[model samples]
Target: MSNLTARLRASLVAALPPEQLLPDSQPEYVRSYVYVFGATTLASFGFLIISGIVLALFGPGWWHVSRIGHFFNSIHFWSVQAFFFFMVLHLWAQFFMAAWRGGRGITWLTGAVTFVVSLGAAFTGYLSQQNFDSQWIAVQGKDAMNAIGIGAYFNLLNFGQMYTYHVFLLPVAVAALTTVHLLQVRRRGVVPPIPPRGLGG
Candidate 1:
């Protein structure tokens, strides 16, 4: 296992050119406020993970009954809300800029898929909160799941079940999808703006 790990690490270092990993210089055109959105998304993701760890450490049981737990839970909840909100803005801006064109279509498509999955994960997280709001959303959301024949596989009323998915299943899926999305983005590099027509050499 150690040998395999070392070989994999070496392969990654070789595959990723140092210039691509950290360039001694970058294009001047890349300098703009719009470019900051990607970094902001990364920052928000960090916040989500840290807050999630804190919530987990407190334990779901503690989170509901204790003041510190409740406060941290609120922070986690709002952090998720903020994460999705910023993600939407970033996705929309990227779309309008036609940043998906050229060879970047795969990166854009992966990101779009991630966004959709993230929404479901976020919804499930809320429903699993096991609060009054959770109860209301669970009842409301079950209809659609039932209508679509998915409720049989997922029980909204089971707090234990919902909590398992919220902390484990949904997060694993989100993280896996996010990993793929980030890899695609890194491989493709950031897309440049479309050139004006008739400027072709």
Candidate 2:
């Protein structure tokens, strides 16, 4: 076991050298405003997570009735809006740049998957609101879930289940996927600039 653990540690260090994982400086190409969107998305997501934890700790009534809870709820809500806004900007920038090029395909795929999973998290969040708005959304959304034929397992009307997903499952998935995507980026580095016209890519 000691030998195995040493080998594992050695392998991990080799795969993720300190310089590669946390470089002192980034490449000149990475200074563009377009690249800034990715970091902005992460900032918004951090706020979403902190506010979400507070809101979850206090339960639905606290968020609905208490002033502090309302403050946290508002924080969570605005954070969600900012998160999606910046995430979309980042995604679109990556798409336009064809960020999958030059061996970054898996990085691109992980980011795309994270975005899709985040959408589910956002939907379930609305269902977990436990308000009249949540009621109407749940009623309307359940049919869509049913039409897809996973209603038995993913019933949108079940507040408990939806809350579990919004507060736990989907968020975990998004965080994990985003972490993996960032790791891949740290390992593989950022995509290079496109070549000028008539200069082969």
Please report the candidate that would top TM-score against the real structure. 2
Q: TM-scores of the models, in the given order?
A: 0.86, 0.95
lDDT of 1 by residue, 29-116 (tens): 7877767776676677677778788888767678878888888787787778778777888887898889887788887888888788
Candidate 2 residue runs with Cα over 4 Å from true position? none
lDDT of 2 by residue, 1-201 (tens): 369989998998887789999988887877779888999999999999999989978886798789999999999999999999999999999999999989999999999999999999999999988899899999998888899898978998889999999999999999999999999988888888888899884
Sequence-dependent TM-score of model 2: 0.95
